[model samples]
Target: MNIRLLAFSFLISASCFSQGEPFRRVNEFYLKGDTRVIGNTILSEHATKVYVRPKGLNDRTEMVYIDIDADSETFSSSNASLDIPEGAKIKYAGLYWAATYPGAKGKQKTRGNRIVYDVKNKRDRPFDLVKLSFPGSNGYTQVQGEVIYDGMRDEIIELKNAAPYVCYSDITDLLVSKNAASGSFTLANVIALEGYMYGGSSAGWMLYLIYEDETEPLQYFTGYHGFSFIKPENTQELSFKNFRAVERGDVKTSVTLAALEGDLILHGDGVSVFKEDTEEYIPLKSRVRYANNFFNSSITINDQKYTDRIPANLNTLGFDLAQVQIPNKNNEVISNDAKQVKLQFKTESDRLFVFFSAFQTEISTDYYQRVVVEGKPDTIIKPAQEKIAEEIQQKETTSQENVQLYGKDGERIVNSRNAALAEMLKVPALRVPGMNSGYYVVNHVFSKRNYALKWKEKMQLKGFSPVRFVNPANNYHYIYLDYSKDPDALYERLLEYRKLKDLKEAWILKVNLD
Candidate 1:
């Protein structure tokens, strides 16, 4: 199979307002126990309200907040953990609170049920809203729909980038919980704030951020600038929505990210992240060898490698699930194509459990094989244009439930890749444009029959978290709740599941395509 590698340079030059900075008056919405981030344009729901503790030390921050205009007086609610550039940090941080409707006239103050207190020095801190401003001289800021945040979020956040300096709200997992986490499968876009030290001038990157809906404007000046306007000796080009690693064995692994087709190749000596475009190659990680690769250092499990490369290595992948990132921001895999993924692992601590879950992921097929030990069911008894009614009628079975559903959307086939089969079976069949169907055997163990309903009940509560049911014999132990309602909630739910399942085997797996 030919793999495609798209060409993009992280070291692109940026300009503040080569064009006019569109106004995105995003200081409008508020949330209770919800969080916001620079990269994430949309605010998210959270059980814990993120507040700033003014007396924060080091990287440990208080409730982070952002004002559309760094100079704006009034502000909206934001979290305390924003990744602000060192230069931008003054003696005090910005803050925002909910406007209370003092009278029927619509005046407001920050009074709501959700109160976030991760930060310290609470009472001393005033209601301030921080503003994330990109140096106009940064790089290209794509004008997207109305969005206040710029991170990689699916569902809630609009897809297209509205500004050059968009933020990736990494808080989804923090607020909504694991199962509700929305964007986890995409390669992350490396967004940073560049200072004059870099090649760009003060006329910083200026792009507009659409807020709430696409029609409303949020913040202005969007584009990711490198830290410290100055170029470090080891500056490398980083792409945001790049790739996601799915399955790996020692060295050679499988990835579900998009294909650039002709530009790059992926190679890692287990220590460094290497990227090559058309003609040249660059070492993305040199000093930071053992990057907590594929997993972070926080939860290190037994590291293993099939390809014995000198000394076995364990590289950390920057952020950790344990670390409290901003809440409710969608930061999933940033792939060129759209595919779904889940948190197979939170960190290396969840390693062995991950392998067990993998077995479950591919379980339906194995289950089907076990169930249909007699032989393959009569899928296509006769000729082409087989009507689903005919298939069912031909079968001695009675209903959609009886025929043995296999995949998501209540299909009969077991293989998810062949989801189209369910549609094809219908009488006046409704068809999904680009789909096919797959089938698998099942070993319905009657002894454990009650397990099925228990699983179904759990799933019912999960709100249809997308799942594929196998044939009659194979059933699930726990039902995946429908997390689509809230990405943050989804992530938290996933975490809860991990806890319930005693799952702490590995970090979320990340396969590279190169």
Candidate 2:
């Protein structure tokens, strides 16, 4: 028996055994509650060419570096533009970058007349730090990112030779501090393998921005990041819930996807959406994306290819970014009342890795109103007989349920609840310079304190005296109606404020000074 052949057979079987699982969800973000009126933008580091594609097999091509910043001293950098509409508020910003790093000391082995690179002794490096330059900045700022998926640390056997990894960072506070709405953004110091590897070498970065636009329809936005190796025989499904479409006929929905190591000429990969009304899956296709070759390396949104990046290669080699609008051409992929969606990705021949996904859908205007007033009493007037009986019953119940209360000084009070309310109304006791150690019934949140103050004044004009509390941690201002040390009392206040039409989406925030 040949020992080498036996070992190679065993390794192939082990790889097959690990090929069917889906991507692990590492981080997720959702815009609900007070931040439901949101929109999103996705910017990638690659450009879409007209008729050019990369040479050789998708996984065996030489990696090309994209450097657009002349002022930076980094080995690799890329720049892209962001255009946020005026009057829109920046709510959340996420930055993600990925690369394939097959260390320097890889060994070559022969398996069935083919040379295979074995990266068994690859050196480890810091894969969680990157440099970022904001719009109109002179120099790059070093940013420590969170490791979303590191194949070296996770030991993903299927992608061991390529050793792909992705990193993510929440740059909301940084962007908000700079007041960066629209401008050229540069990302530098992205580490990746520059030469050929067992699998194809690829590197790219993406910025996903979610903002609040009151002029646009109310939307529910969700974003997820993970790493999954997609093979020919495997299928990956992503499910999104907790949101529903409006009852109108012109509901709009979209999905954004990003992947690595996809071939431009490869075929047989497809994406599908589950239609709730039809009880079947519909293949998603656009003007540039075909039903059988959905993951081809390109950067397209809503049937339009974006060429707004430096060194805009029509073919991204192995990087893919697409934002496809659902129900295009009058296809009822999602119904008016559907609350959930499942997206399926499959390939019959090509192999790729999907790392990020985002979904957005327009919601009803009255959705928050219905949620706020679900259990509230009706405003209709009652008949004389019923009103008289209810008043008598209320008086008797009040007399029986009266309880004495005491203050911090041990002074007796007529009613416990009313005394607490009176003390709260007398002076703003919970108003602290910074975030206090208590629960706050928050009606609104703003990235800038000035904007928070403006909204507070507007609310005050409408018979509301909301207080503003600043969070030093994230530089966000919390505009709240009430606060208390007791969580139950604060929650009750949240419910009461939610009953009002203007404050229908009020929420609660808890802070601990310690």
TM, every model: 0.16, 0.62
**Reference-based lDDT, each prediction:** 0.20, 0.59
Model 2, 1-514: lDDT tens per residue? 0000000000001112233223333323333321211111111222212224444343444344555566546656766667778767878787888777666334446799997755554545566787888774557888899876666655567566456777888888888887877777778777776544565566677777778776767777666555566666677665776555665456677766655645667677788887653357789889988898776666676688766765555566666666677753332566454567777767787666666666677765455345433634222221322343455456546743254566799887654354444443444334446456776667788997557766765554444546776766577787877667875455555555666667887765656632
How much is the lDDT of residue 435 in candidate 1? 22
By summed lDDT, which 10 consecutive residues of candidate 1 come out lowest? 352-361
> Model 1, range 172-265, lDDT digits (tens) per residue?
2222222212211111112221111111100001111111222321111112221111111222222222111111111111111100111011
For model 2, which pairs clash? 48-314, 49-314, 59-200
| Residue-pair clash count for candidate 2 | 3
The TM-score, computed over Cα atoms with residue i paired to residue i, of candidate 2 is 0.62
Using lDDT as the measure, which candidate wins? 2
Ten-residue stretch with the least lDDT total in model 2: 1-10
